[model samples]
Target: MDQLKYQMVIQWSDEDDCFLVALPDFPGSYWRTHGDTYDEAFANGKEALESLILAYESMGDNLPIPKVASSV
Candidate 1:
């Protein structure tokens, strides 16, 4: 959801030969999922985000605060 305000960054990786997705707001490494195409990568990223949110809620853990961009 837009309310979460999590950043999803998708980029092409030469080494992996696929599009890599990074959920910067989440913990762990930048790379979370990959896809042969850009769209697939995006879909995978969304799925990953949903799973993460559910996991946190089920554990009764506090979710990470979303970051906001400054106008300046």
Candidate 2:
């Protein structure tokens, strides 16, 4: 859901030749999914986040609290 404001870290990997997406809120793998372009990476990251939430719910695990950003 849009209400879940989890942090998504998108970075370009020269060696991999693609954009890597990582969900800091969710533990486990450093990189959940990736894409060839930034746009693709963003979309993939959203899908991955949804899947991760579903997986945690199905497994009866508590979802991690989303980190909030502070304004300067």
Candidate 3:
């Protein structure tokens, strides 16, 4: 299987205790881990993405549905 790449944006959340991870291309697919630091959150997010990707692949499903960018 080809290596799949997905962007995981990690941002600090003041109201929340954990690091916020947002999958820009995948809506409603965000998760947070019990982390008090940025690095911890980033690490957790990476693990989360890896698991999600594996699950999808195991089910024979396509990962992110890349959109075709329109040129002006």
Candidate 4:
């Protein structure tokens, strides 16, 4: 299957002392993973994305539609 392009929001968290990652496609859930650096956060986010897709597939669940950015 073609890879789904999910939106990943990575931000620095003072409280957590690390870069936090959020998957908008799977809302309402807390941040799945974090990293000490931006690059690490990005890499972890990609891995999490793939794992999520595989999980939903194994459970026969439909994947959420990726949010598209609207040009203003």
Best by lDDT: 2
| C-alpha TM-score for every candidate | 0.91, 0.95, 0.69, 0.91
Candidate 3 lDDT trough over 10 residues, lowest sum: 25-34
Each model's C-alpha lDDT? Answer: 0.91, 0.96, 0.69, 0.90
TM-score of 2: 0.95
Q: Please report the TM-score between candidate 3 and the true structure.
A: 0.69
Candidate 4 residue-wise lDDT, 17-62, digit = tens: 9999999888568698899999999999989988998999999999
Can you write out model 3's per-residue Cα lDDT over 1-72, one digit (the tens) per residue? 235566667877788866787666555645534357888877787787777778888999888864445698
Could you give the candidate ranking by lDDT, starting with the highest? Answer: 2, 1, 4, 3
Worst 10 residues of 2 by lDDT: 24-33
Stretches of model 1 off by over 4 angstroms after superposition: none
Clash count list over all predictions: 0, 0, 0, 0
Task: Give model 1 RMSD, 1 decimal.
Answer: 1.1
Best by TM-score: 2
For model 1, residues 1-72, the per-residue Cα lDDT tens digits are: 556788889999999999999998888887999999999999999999999999999999999987778999
What clash pairs does model 4 have? Answer: none
Q: In model 1, how large is the Cα lDDT of residue 13?
A: 94
RMSD of 2: 0.8
- Cα-lDDT of candidate 4: 0.90
